[model samples]
Target: MPGIVPRGRRGPEVAGTGEDDSVWAEGQVRTITDLARLAGVSAGTVSRALAGNTLVNARTRERIQQLARSHGFQLNQMASNLRRQKTGVVGVAIPLGHDRRQQISDGFFMTLLGHLADELTQRGYDLMLRRVLPERDEDWLSRFSGSGMVDGLIVIGQSDQFERIEAAAAEYLPMVVWGNHQEGQRHCVVGTDNRLGGRLAAERLIAAGATRLAFFGDAEPMEFAARFAGACDVAARAGVSILACPTSLSVEPMTREIAHHLHSNAGGFDGIFAATDTIAVACLKALRDAGRAVPGHVRLVGFDDLPIASQTSPPLTTIRQDIAAGARALVDLLMRRLGGENTESLVMPPRLIARGTA
Candidate 1:
């Protein structure tokens, strides 16, 4: 045949031969083993060459690659990963223990996730996202950690399952969380100093001449709670009263809740410190509907200085959490942990972005 090539001692072989290749032929090359036979090299050498491993000389690698292309051979990545005991995947879990209704599409989360995807992709890893409700599944962490689908994990938000995360951290090293960091926590964490951010928001409201302050947002989550506590600290020292007007993060409920708070406590609080920019923006609209003026009647401040903060009327005066920096730290710390290194939690400082609301 025109396509036949001499294989020296092995005799001549026809190109593109299938299973029915006569007893004289060695059959078609469709896998690494088949390619190795045709290339007169060991399967290990063929695998290394196909993977572009420098251990295989450039000459042999190029020859194997050419042979693979000619025979239409393809390496099974899944099978290869299994043999190497690596998935080349990083799992990102968002545990909504405090608010199960919170979606991954939420502004703050989407922003952080975008940065995370960028960081992970730059490092040659794939991202696998999972939104988990820790309340419904107590073993959510264990299941994800034990599953061989991902090589490492990055958890967003501690929510109310701090204890569960602590337990998992004790056993899982390749895990990093984004939340408030305590003095003696075991898990590696990367997040803003929410308490300090809260202090900054409260101080700005106070400086803007507001005495009575109300914190808007659910304070049950660790991050929110820290912020509330910080604001409370400032309020206490300044001899000003601060109240917690519990609000949900869900859009529909948050809108209604802010309106209700405005209606119920019309003149109770002159300064409002929202835990998130999302809540602060809603509160601003509610204040307008209630015929209250910003700074003239009420001074408002929010956290997480999201993009929407600047777009708001009178631009929101809020605490800016470096979400991009936090995301980078999370991936960097997780990569370190994956390398068997014990990394400490990273707490990035929050800056006050003075716009116009406060």
Candidate 2:
């Protein structure tokens, strides 16, 4: 069996030779079987060589591996996973409609997803997206975790389902969260210092001589709530009365609501701090419709320096979170947990990107 190899079904070449005429004619090696034929070795020997087993002769193993690498022959992951009883997959869950209006395309979630995908792929883990719709289902995490679809889970947003997440964490599920630091979170979390972001936004508005300020965005999500709380705390100290305007899920309705709030208030607020860049954009449109000049009539600030923030008519000043770093921290924490090491939560600092608005 030194030189004898199987011939491709397409045709037959001279026997007892390492070179398969069909493979040479095709000018490509498609599989380990093809490499085996080319190197005059069996598929098992190729596998052993790729696995770095010392059983195979060093010279033969090195030659086979070099050929495999040159030919770009990848191992059959399905077969490998079957043998190992593991999927090498990581589940990423984002509450798509948890707020009944939020979508996956929301700037923050979209950015987080891109970073997570990149980090996971680089670390040799396949990302499996799981968009949880709390409106339709309650026990989404349990189902995702128990199905054995992934070695660990990374949840993007801790919507109104924090309790459920806590329960899953209590059960010792290997998972990481990307959101605010809650009082009793059992799972590892990687998030921005949202409270400081909000405070910075408010402080900027105040420094610009804004006395009457309004807080835009919902207060249900813990992240937004913390930002709102920070603003309120600073507002209280500065003797500025802060108004609250909850935004709708869609831009149209949210714009209308913001317009109505501004029009009815009638010179009540001199500045506004939006919880997110998306909400900030809606507020800008509403202000324009209401004939209010940005920073001239009412200064504005927003969280998350999304792409659209800088392209707005006058540009938007926003709190910038280290999305890439946060993504890395989440994946790193998850990997540590998977490696049987206890990891701690991480909270990244937020910085204000001052632009035309504030």
Candidate 3:
């Protein structure tokens, strides 16, 4: 019986039955109940301590955790899930583009994803990214948030799928979206004030004495739509005309479209407001190709203030979104819903970062 140990508690000096008996045995501490008995606490207290619940006194939680660690005891996640009826995981979903096959390769998505991973980890929740094609996956939301695999969901894009998102919300799905707020919307949303960002970009250019202006970026994405609307509003109020030049999410196509717009409207625009930094970068290239000078010939403003915005020659003047704050808001809202609390949609204000481009 070399592997066998005593069944019950033993004296301090008992051979092979003290703190040294760390390996799993038939009668050793294995369950929360067993660990609770050894730690002189209730099974409920042990559960809360293991979950990092703040209700347990700090010292008590530490002592119980230390005892569990010393005895090589780990909670069974499956059993724990069954007990709490929670998966302890958060699902993050990003909608595919209109092409249905485009991966989320944009810098904005990458930066937001990184911040989300960090915030979710710090909150003791595991992140599970669910990439879905709306065209192929009609019930993507249910499959992701209702599969008993996650406690809540965070959806990144709200393109033309707002209706489906609203439907899911009506069904009481615990989720949040990272996009613009719209009329009659019911889902919890965390996003920038895109309209304000757009308006500010237009107004700044106007104040800089640029009359003829152009707004770039496709309006298919609802967020960009809001930004475009804002820019148009400002242009209309100031008695300035804004030429709407639509561009796609992809770079090459967007560049071509921008170049076409610029070429066709040659000598028409002296300022431009791009819905995103990527679009602004493309505009820069197009303008350079057309032999137009920046700031002097065309005062440009972009949104998102991405890293490349600062690195570009005659750095991009852009609207900055508080990405870290947005991530925190999204996670906090979802967690609150998971905790049975009613949460409202949060909108972070946008700031205009003045640079050489404007």
Question: Which candidate leads in lDDT?
Answer: 1
Q: Estimate, for each residue in 235-301, the C-alpha lDDT of model 3 and write its tens digit.
A: 9999999888887768667778998899999988999999889889989888988899998899999
- Model 3 alpha-carbon miss at residue 92, Å: 0.6
lDDT of 1 at 187: 90
lDDT tens digits, residues 1-358, model 1?
Answer: 7786654233455564443434443465656777787788999999999889999999999999999988877677688788889888999999987666755667899999999999999999999999888778889998998998899999998888889999999988999999999999899899999999999999999999999999999999889999999999999999999988999999999999998888888889999999999999999998988889997899999998999999989899999999999999999999998999999999999999999899
The lDDT per prediction is 0.90, 0.85, 0.86
Top-scoring candidate (TM-score): 1
> Where does candidate 3 clash, by residue pair?
none
Better of 2 and 3 by TM-score: 2
lDDT score for candidate 3 against the true structure: 0.86
Q: 1 or 3: which has the higher lDDT?
A: 1
Off by over 4 Å in 2: 1-44, 62-74, 100-102
Q: List the candidates' TM-scores in order.
A: 0.90, 0.84, 0.81
Clashing pairs for model 1 are none
- The superposed Cα distance between candidate 1 and the true structure at residue 356, in angstroms, equals 1.0
Error of 2 at 26 (Å): 16
